[model samples]
Target: MNKSVFILPVIVILIAAILSSIFIVDEREKVLVLRFGRVVQTIDEPGLNFRIPLMDQVVTYDDRIISIDMAAQEVIPSDDRRLIVDAFARYRIVNLERIRQATGAGGDQAIAIADQRLENILNAETRTVLGEVTSGDILSTDRDALMLRIRNAAIAEASALGIEVIDVRLKRTDLPSQNLERTFERMVSERQREAEDERARGREAATRITALADRTVVELESDASREAQIVQGEADASRNAVFAQAYGQDTEFFEFYRSLEAYREGLATGNARLVMTPPEDFFDYLRSPNGNVAE
Candidate 1:
């Protein structure tokens, strides 16, 4: 019975010893030991750690980088243009003691507090800084400089919360819905006007070229027609002069030949007629010497 009693107490003591000195620190976490609600020691390296179990409590906090996405906010620029800005930030705990003091222990509540604080700082800083810049400036070649400025401002503000802001980036920056529509409409109208101007210029050039070509063709045709008419007039005058010379060379023979041609043309109707005339004229050739008509 005494042996049993000793074994029971020994087992109980062993169990108590096991429970008292055991602590665990994860690879991605840091543990802080609090004795009677007062910080006694902090364990930064990951592995097994020891502390008086009943008298001390170990609180673990994540040391890895965390991301917080802020909601899209409407901001008015210096030019009074409304824009929707979406942003996010990356942060990590730098000072565990300060974090513990500020946010009693680490969990969703601590993260929430940190997130809210960061967001507030970001919002105020962004509004103040960005409000002084126009929309064009924000989206211009200076955008990188602006982003750097925003990151610096956010880091400066978040430093007080024991959180190190690694980066602050804007996910998107856009004009409001109505402003977008107006901008698109203006761009479309401008493009249309430019196209119309180009078309008009092209048409004018084509018309000028066509008119010049038509004038050139008309001039060539008129010149050719005039040349042809001049040649024809010369040809007709030459033929008439040649005929007049021939007729003047033998007047009597020409008259006789012309009379014969006239008689033949008149007799083609198959009718004959006689007329009295003196034989002394050229018609006497077809008459007898007695002044009577021969055949």
Candidate 2:
């Protein structure tokens, strides 16, 4: 029984040691094997790796690019205008041993430490580079050039941490909270001014159209009245010429016709009464067919 117990313990230890000595590095990972707190080997190839059990420590780091988001910061440009700037950076670990040395930590702790340091470097560079340009440039297409400058500056600083800064980008920029209200007020005032100008123009157009319509109406009415008067005058002239021609043809018959027309018009009223005495010639047309006065 004592011999069996010793053999089982030996087997267990061997198994544990075998498992501990073997490490698997993923395709996206880089590993460091450390002996007694000292880096003994750096493995970047993906596959099964072996290390001395109980004597070596394995630290793994991602080999892919990582991103770090920077907090929003206030920047004062050359124009003395303040801007709220938010930025981010993409980077990859270039040197594992250097990163462990720079961070003074191994494994995942080193990545965290490196990211924190890089964020600080990026923030400082963003401020420094943006401060050199005017606000217009920061807010324009020239912003691409400014971001390139920030990335270059960050790369120089990040190299100390064994980080390769691939790119830097300004994500969002806006006026500060206190300035936003004032900007909105200024914009509202401008819109109101434009609206008032448009209304004034509309009123002017309406007035012009109304005046034109009134003048046109007056012109049309005056022309129609003149035409009516001309037609009436022509009709009266033609009537007078007919009367004169009939009078010249026979004066006695013409006089008789005029008397008969006057009588008919005077008697046409509903309740008309004659109040004056008529001359003898007035009845001459009724008394004689030739309209001569009866002697």
Candidate 3:
């Protein structure tokens, strides 16, 4: 009974130690075997991995690309315009050994430190590149070139820490909240000023048109009045010529016609007023039907 008990305990310990020594490395992960907190082996391929059960520690790191979102930071462009820039980066750990040494940490702590360092690098480069350009360029399609510049700069710095900075992108670039309101207000004011200027110009144009029309009306009326006066004078001269011509044809007939005309006019309604003696030559026509003078 004692022998069986001792053998069973030994077998149990052996099985436990064996199981602990063997680890399965997934294809998505990189495994590191660390002895006394020092990396001894780096297994990148997927399969079975072995390590010293109690003396060696295995650490797994993701082999996939990692993303880091930098906090939004403010940058002042060359034109002295301030902008809030939010950027992100894609990076991968190319050399786990170097990353481990550079971060001076292990496991999750190491990843965190590395991420923080990368974020800092990305932010610095983003600010540097964006600061050299105008805000218009940053917001324009040329922003792709600017992002490439930032990525190149960040890659140079991140390579030291075993990080391959694949890309750097500006996610959002905008004016600060406080500046946004002010910019909108300025735009509105400018539009309003432009509208006022247009209205003023329109009013001036309208006034000029009105003045021109008034002057034209006055000239036209003056021309028409002069034409009417000329026509009236011509008619009066033509009537006097006709009367003189008739008088020269027959003096007695002209005198009788003149008498008839005077009587017709004097005897007209609303104007039949006469204050003359009755036996005057004006009665010659009335005294003789044949219009002879009654001497």
Candidate 4:
């Protein structure tokens, strides 16, 4: 009975030790084995890993990419424009030992310190690059290129932490409220000036069109008057030709017709006087009352 009890306790202790010595390393994690606080082995692959029981300790860290958002920082460009920038960075640990040494912290403390250090590096680089570029570059399509340069520079400085900087990006970039208000006022002034210029141009064009229309109307009237005079002159010429032809054909009949026309006009007005001797020419038809003058 004493032997069986002793063996059972020994077996239980072995099982417990075995269970404690073996640990699982997930695919997304990396494990570091420490012997008396000194790093002994690093397991990067996912599987069951073994360590010295009661002497070795395991520390796991995330192997996937991590993100850190930086706070908004203000910077001035070469053009002396003040701007606010918000950015973020993506990074992954490449060498666990180097990262542990650089951070000088453990577990969650390491991650926090690393993230803070990343922001500091990124901010310094962003300020440096922005100071070299114009404000137009910040707002232009070339902003991507500017961000790439910032990321590259930051990566160079931060590589000592054994982390790879995948990318860095600007989240928001704009001027302060005071600058925006001033810009808005300037834009309004420019638009108003342009509107005034456009209205003046419109007035000038309208005046030109009106003056041209008046000139056209006057020209049209002058042309119509000239055409009417030409038609009247032609009719007069035709009538004169017809009268001359008739007179040449019959002189006596023409003389009688002229006398009759003169008498009718002279008599058309009530009791009107001609104050001339009439029987020799105009009165001949009235006095004869027959074909005697013509015959």
lDDT of 2: 0.89
Q: For this target, which candidate reaches the highest TM-score against the unseen true structure?
A: 4
* TM-score quality measure for candidate 1: 0.67
How does model 2 score by TM-score? Answer: 0.69
Across 114-170, the per-residue lDDT of candidate 1 in tens digits comes to 888888888877787789999888766558777778778888667777789888777
lDDT (Cα, 0-100) at 261 in candidate 4: 80
lDDT of 2 by residue, 1-295 (tens): 9999899999999999998889899999998889998999999899998999889988888899999888999999999889999988999998988898899886678878998999999989988998998988888855788999999888878998988999999998888999988889999999999999999999999999999999999999999999999999999999999999999999977887898899898779689876765565567666766557566
Candidate 2 minimal-lDDT segment of 10 residues:
276-285
Candidate 3, residues 1-295: lDDT per residue as tens digits? 9999999999999999999999999988887789999889999899997889889988877788888888999999999889999988888888888888798765677778989999988888877888898999998965788988988888878988987999888889999998998889999999999999999999999999999999999999999999999998999999889989998998888898889998888888895578879888788889987668676
TM for every model, in the order presented, reads: 0.67, 0.69, 0.74, 0.77
RMSD of each: 6.9, 5.3, 4.1, 4.2
In candidate 1, position 22 carries an lDDT of 89
Alpha carbon lDDT of each predicted model: 0.82, 0.89, 0.87, 0.87
What residue runs in model 1 are displaced by over 4 Å at the alpha carbon?
A: 1-18, 36-38, 128-146, 178-181, 222-295
Q: Which candidate tops lDDT?
A: 2
**TM-score of structure candidate 4:** 0.77
Summarize candidate 4's per-residue lDDT along 1-295 as a digit string, tens digits.
9999899999999999999999999999887788887889988899998988989988877798999999999999999989999999999887788778888665677778889888899999999999899888898765889989999898877788878899999988899888999988999999999999999999999999999999999999999999999999999999989889999999878877777787677779686766766545555566675665632
Clashing pairs in 2: none
